[model samples]
Target chain A: MALLTAVELTIWVLEGQIPPPIPVPGVKLGLASVVTLAAMAVLGRREAGCILLLRVILGCLFAGSFSAIIFSLAGGVLSWAVMASLIGLFPEKLLWVVSVFGAIGHNAGQLLAAVAVTKTPGLFWYGPALLTSAIVTGAFTGLGAMYLVRALRKYRERRGF
Target chain B: MKRKTVFWLALFAVLAALGAGTYLLRGVAGRRAVVSVDGEPMRTVDLTAAAVPYEFTVETDYGRNTVRVSQGRIAVVDADCPNRDCVKQGTISDGAIPIVCLPHHLVIQIED
Candidate 1:
């Protein structure tokens, strides 16, 4: 669990280092989500939740930002909840579906946090753009996680992790 | 079509519909740019009436942002916020999406 948390933190920081691909506010590739998804698929929901929580807290500390923690926590917790609930309904082969939904939930949670922080109802106007980006980015990360999960499973079977 | 394919199609259709709807609704030309801080109206600019481009800096308890107003458009060209999200948002020619500075608690929205 600690190892996974460290990995997540590294990925989060690394992803942050890259400039945003799109020139829009509040849009990100969310590459760190791949680690969370892989953890959930391989380890378990509880373990994945622990890694996510630890990563968010430690990530904020390392990043040295307080407000970011709020948005990250809101999005991370909501995404985890969606993944945990949907993982059971979908077959393992359909992890991407769970991931897509989870990404949507993450955006929704972050949007809510942004609205609350800014206290602007007008911000909701960006919802459609967010949703569209979520679908595209979510699919990318989901496929990445699916490949990672398969590769890791093979490695575990070979090494008995 | 298979059930799974159908489900995916339906989901995509709904999301696309929403995107199209919001684009049409918010992308229309608006004469006014409404600036607000902490949910309070700060100023309103007549986008259509601005003959020449002008820039103004907004400083509040939260932070500072430099907004530019031109004919029929408004945008935050610079900001002190670490994220620089508002500045990166470029400009809002319409009402589709409000340029937001979360750290500064500022919003610039276009309205008819």
Candidate 2:
């Protein structure tokens, strides 16, 4: 079930188009991060990491795009690492910050890959640009998780997690 | 008020200041130029000061391409190229980036 959820998240972002702004490069609905955030809050880092790796590998195979895999893997690993670090440092209530930082981390990882692929350090100038995008998208996704958790907790207590 | 919240928030603020600053600076300088394919240098124009929108077409051994530039931006409004990636690149306003038609090898760069 978790596996299915993660796969669906990846597919939605790739095809989904949000209006006007088009997209800021790699940024998206960040649905995967939603799963990441939920795993951290409900499951644990190890379980979250398992989901993360599975999704990255499966998403890569399904998409059949090695380049996309490289981009997403780097971002996913880095974001997961950031989430783990922040969760350790902060109280449970502060998961939103995890989303923001993870988003930035995701961009940094992707930017690093971009720099490697382009063989251009000038691309590093895009780092901050990508980070700002992470924040907006991250905040939105983070808030999404926040509300989702509130609802899930009620359901879980009734049905048991 | 958690320690991690403080830590992450501070870091994102720095990133935002730097990123938005660069993006806004990019907006201010305003750039427009032209690129060519078939190893030919056609012409370069400063789009910021142009009095009106310009229509341009490139003729290559491959085929012909028609582009439109308006408001200091460029897009391949029409092209005979197999893949219309150039037309789909949309209006490129970023100074550092250029609208490129890979099939036709036409480039529109924004310049100082």
Candidate 3:
């Protein structure tokens, strides 16, 4: 569990090092979410949840500014809620697939928060622009996680480290 | 996979088309006195008559955009930032759309 928490932190920092966020409305590589998958795979759900929660909070503190916290927090919290509920039903391999929905949920949550904060419905016009991009980015991140899981399984097998 | 790809592609096309059409086809109405952010009715000044000077600041994350409004027209006469999206945004006659600087949290939308 301690090792996984450290891993989560490492991944969060790595994700942050990916400087200059995409110029698009809502898109991220989400390297930390790959660590999230690993945590859930190796540790049980409870431990994984703790790691994720801490990762998000600390990640926000370290990587993001004040305004960014709102968007990431909404996305992380909503994504975790929905994923936690569905985890029981789906196979472990499906974690990344669920993460896609989580990313979209995060975007939707951020947009809703922005509209509420700004009192502008016209801003929602960005929705279609965001969602289409989300699918592509989500799929890319999901595929990356799939490969990471596959590679991690192989390394853990050989090194037993 | 082929069918799913086709379905998603179609959905994207439709959404893009709708967004573009709505943006371009939006109608403009005649100018009148409208309430602005400061809760004052900004009356339309006669363009052919003498010009009046007005100035306002647009707060942005990177910096601020200072705008000048005169007789039936507005422009970003001075700005601190280089991108100049605020300057190019021209006059915000429509309340529905405002001069938005995404880099900055500033918006100048019209209101009733």
Candidate 4:
């Protein structure tokens, strides 16, 4: 769990440095979610939740912003909950589908946070754009997580860990 | 592909298409730019009437943002937030997307 958390934190921090592929606010690759999903698949939901919580808290600390923590926590918790509930229903091959839903949940949570903080219902206008980006980015991260899960299983079998 | 895979793919495709359509068909170009801080309208600039580009600073409890407005366009050219996402957003002349600075709780949108 600690190792997974560290990897996720690193990805979250590094991903922030890269300019968003889409110029829209709140749209990004969300690459760190790959680790969270993989951990949930391999380790279990509780472990995955731990890793995700640690990553969000630590990532915010590294960024040194109080407001950011609120957004990250809202997104992280919602995404984790959605993935955790869907993880078992879908087979490994269909992990990407589960990921897409989780990504949507993440964006919804962040949008809600933004609205609540700013008290601006107008922010909802960005919802469609966010939803579109989440689906696209979610599929990519989900595929990455699926491969990571498979590779880890193979490695464990070979090494007998 | 498997039936389950196909079903999921179709579902996502429909959702993506719907989202994309709504985003693309927001509205025609807008000439009035409304700048809001903490959900309160701080300023409304008439981009169509402004022949000369002008700038103003909005300072709130969160931080500060420097907004630039010109004919038919508006943008946050500067901000003291850590990310500067509002500034990086460049400018907007339509209602498709608003310039948002999450840290400073600022939003600028072009409306008809």
Candidate 5:
């Protein structure tokens, strides 16, 4: 759990340093979700949630932004819930689909937070763009997590854990 | 294909289509630009009526952004915010997307 949390934090911070590929606000690759997804597949939903919660809290502290915590928590929790509910229903081969759903949930949650924070209904104008970016980024991170999960399974088997 | 795969694929196609539909349909041709800060109306300008291009600055606790306006369009040309995502967004002639400076809690939406 500790190691996974660290990995997630590192990726989250590293990704933050990179400018978004496009000029859209709130659109990100969310590469840290790769670790969360792998944990969900390998370590179970509860463990994954723990890692996600820790990573989000500590990440916000390290980043030194109080407002960021609300957005991160909102996005992270919704994404985790979506993935947890769908993981067992979908075969391992379809983890990308699960990831895509989680991404949509994440974006929706953040949109709600943005709306509430700004008290602006007009911000909903960005919804379509956010959803489109979520699908693209989610597919990329989902494939990454799938490979990570497979590698970890082999490693665990070799170590007889 | 398996039922699950087929179902997901169909769902993805529908969602993609919906997103595209929303994108193409959300643009408003109105020449008015409404600028708001933290939900409060900051400024409103009719882009079509502006005889000369002008710029204005919005200062807030979050940050500052300079918005530029001209005939038929609006944009954030400069901002002190770190990301500068708003500046890079260039301009919006329609309501399809607002010029959002998240750090500044600022939004410039063009509407009729």
Candidate 6:
């Protein structure tokens, strides 16, 4: 879990350096979520939750912004919950579908947080754009997680760990 | 393709289509730009009437943002926030997407 958390934290911090490929406000690749899903698949829901919580908290400390923590926590928790509930239903081949839903949940949570903090219902106008981005990015990350899970399983079996 | 694969693909295709439709249809050029801070209206500028481009600063308990307005567009020219996402957003001339600074709790939207 600690190793997975470190990897996730690194991806989150590094991903922050790249300007969003899509110029839309609040849109991100959310690559760190690949680790979360993989951990859930390999380890367990509880372990995945622990990794996500640690990554969010430690990520905010590294970013050094109080406001960011709120958004991160909102998105991270919502995404984890959605993926956790759906993880059991989806076979490894269908992990990407669960990931897409989790991605939507993550963005929805962040949008809600933004609307609540700014008290601007107008922010909802960005919802469609966010939803579109989430689906695209989620599919990619889900595929990545699926491959990672397979590779990890092979490695463990080979090493007899 | 497998039945399950085809099902998920069709579902996502429908969703993406719906999202794209709403997104493309949401933007209509408007002359008025409303600036709000912490959900309260702070300023409203009629972009069509502005003969010259001008800038103003919005300072709140959170931070500061310098908003620039021209004939029919608005943007955050500067900000003291860590991310500067608002400034990076460039400008908006339609109701499509508002310039949002999450760090400073600022939003600038163009409306008819």
Q: What TM-score would you give candidate 6 relative to the actual structure?
A: 0.95
Query: What is the TM-score ranking, best to worst?
Result: 4, 6, 1, 5, 2, 3
What are the interface RMSDs of all the models?
2.0, 5.8, 6.1, 1.3, 2.4, 1.3
Candidate 4 colliding pairs: none
The B-chain TM-score of model 2 reads 0.64
lDDT of 6 by residue, A54-105 (tens): 9999988887877888998999999999999999997788999999999999
Interface RMSD of candidate 6?
Answer: 1.3
Candidate with top DockQ is 6
Where does the lowest 10-residue lDDT sum fall in candidate 1 chain A? A17-26
Q: What DockQ does each prediction reach against the true complex?
A: 0.54, 0.24, 0.12, 0.70, 0.43, 0.71
Q: Using DockQ, rank the candidates from best to worst.
A: 6, 4, 1, 5, 2, 3
Flag regions of model 6 displaced more than 4 Å: none
Instruction: List candidate 3 segments past 4 Å from native.
Output: A1-4, A7-22, A64-67, A91-96, A154-161, B1-112
Interface root-mean-square deviation of model 4 in angstroms is 1.3
Task: Give the poorly placed runs of model 4, Cα more than 4 Å off.
Answer: none
Write the residue-wise lDDT of candidate 5 on A65-142 in tens digits.
666778789999999999999999988989989899899889988888878877789888778877877787888889
Q: Give the Å shift of residue A138 in candidate 3.
A: 1.3
Question: What does candidate 3's lDDT look like per residue over B1-112, in tens digits?
Answer: 5565556457645655664455444424224323222222223333223266667665534566676666544455556543444565566543334444433444444333
Each model's TM-score?
0.90, 0.69, 0.58, 0.95, 0.85, 0.95
Residue-level lDDT tens digits of model 1 in A59-120: 98887777788988999999999999988887776777788888999999989988898899
* lDDT of candidates 1 onward, in order: 0.85, 0.68, 0.56, 0.89, 0.85, 0.89
Candidate 1 reaches a DockQ of 0.54
TM-score of 4: 0.95
| CAPRI docking class of candidate 5 | acceptable
Better of 2 and 3 by DockQ: 2
lDDT of 1 by residue, B15-89 (tens): 867875776677788989889998888999999888899999999988899999999988899888766757767
